[model samples]
Target: MTVMNADEIRKLLPHRWPFLLLDRVIELKPGVSGVGIKNVTISEPFFEGHFPTESIMPGVLIVEALAQMTAVVYCTGALQAMREAEQEVAATAEAQLEPAEEIDISSRVGYLVAIRDMKFMKPVVPGDQLLLKVKIGRSVGILSKVNVAAYVGKVCVVEGTLSVSQRP
Candidate 1:
């Protein structure tokens, strides 16, 4: 298992700023699975308007963090497959210096298809460090299902099923 700091995470996911829910990737097994962390703070942008005096991290953001972690797994798997495909092509066929200019229409193969059976078990408050675990559940052609969970220490804060499709 390899750990990815925030910088590496930024390279993998397109999210930025207060929208980037993942603070760091705690563990990553490349194409197989990954886990990430999100630190809740009073200074978080949402808390100000959500409740000035007594604020809590929104349940939706917790879910988003879990989703982003899941997406990392998806991107990793797809990139690995893409690299393998390229290697196989290079090995068997004559290599060309010219790259495909069409933006590789196959890149849109991955997209989120569904978010199901989501449950919020507890409130995630300021100063809480959320640990998110996401794993590849099943794959049917270009579609894949990922099971995800978020925890505050030993307590489960949220859990759900995330379905992703490689077909545009």
Candidate 2:
């Protein structure tokens, strides 16, 4: 099922055109995990200079796509948690106490602090649709580790571990 389209994704993420790597999120489990899709096309600006004769999607961009997917998973999860917390607080509040203001979790941005064990097995070219998968790992304090992978059909093109942290 399509959990989030490009329009919805834009509301959760800050990335804009030409930079937003994900086209649609086919599967999402809030903060736990998610799968996103990106359709690479010849019309992409990077293709013009990456190789004028033969276009190839950069390996770094693949990694960036993976990171973006991870962000969506983590940030959305945080937003959900915040909403639940607010609800709980409201339910338990006394009549004399005023409801607390809503926190804008959407404004929180996650940064890729570290990327490890990255391996690119094949080159991604135009016309290929990349499937990005991200799963959350152990989290300590404000930092979280996620297992990320990118695939074209059944072939794994990129795989790595990404460490992400939210900015206060």
Candidate 3:
């Protein structure tokens, strides 16, 4: 089942056209793990500069796609936590919780802090559909580490570990 389509993804992420690499999320388990798809086409803006002669998707962008997937995982978990907190606050009768500052979660963007052990096994080009997979690792404070991998068909194109931090 599709957990999130492009429109829903846009609502949760700050990225816009030409920058938002994720197309659809097929599997999602909040902060635990997720899998996203990116259909690379000739119309992609990056292809224009990445290579005029032979269009090849940049390895960095593949890493970015992985990072974006990680963001979706973490952000969705945060949003759900917020909702649960709100419900708990509402249930309290005599003990009233202080009003928390309202922040627009939809507009929030997470930063990719570090990428390690990245391996680009194959070149991604037009018509290639990438499957981005992310698994959560140990987290410290607001920073999280995720094991990320991108696959074209059954072939692994890129694999790495990414460190991401949510904005305050």
* CA lDDT of each prediction against the hidden true structure: 0.81, 0.90, 0.90
What is the overall TM-score of model 3 with all chains considered together? Answer: 0.91
Identify the candidate with maximal TM-score: 2
Worst 10 residues of 3 by lDDT: 93-102
TM-score of model 2 (CA atoms): 0.93
Candidate 1 lDDT (Cα, 0 to 1)? 0.81
lDDT per residue as tens, model 3, 80-137: 8887888777787546767767667766667888989999999999999999999999
Clash count, candidate 1: 1
Tens-place lDDT digits, model 1, residues 1-168: 337788877777777898999888878776678888898898899999877777988887887888788777777777777778877888788777466453342343356778899999998898999999999887887777888999999999899988877655
Report the lDDT of model 1 for residue 55: 93
Q: Which model is ahead, 1 or 2, in terms of TM-score? A: 2
* Candidate 3 regions with alpha-carbon error over 4 angstroms: 94-103
* Model 2: per-residue Cα lDDT at residue 13: 84
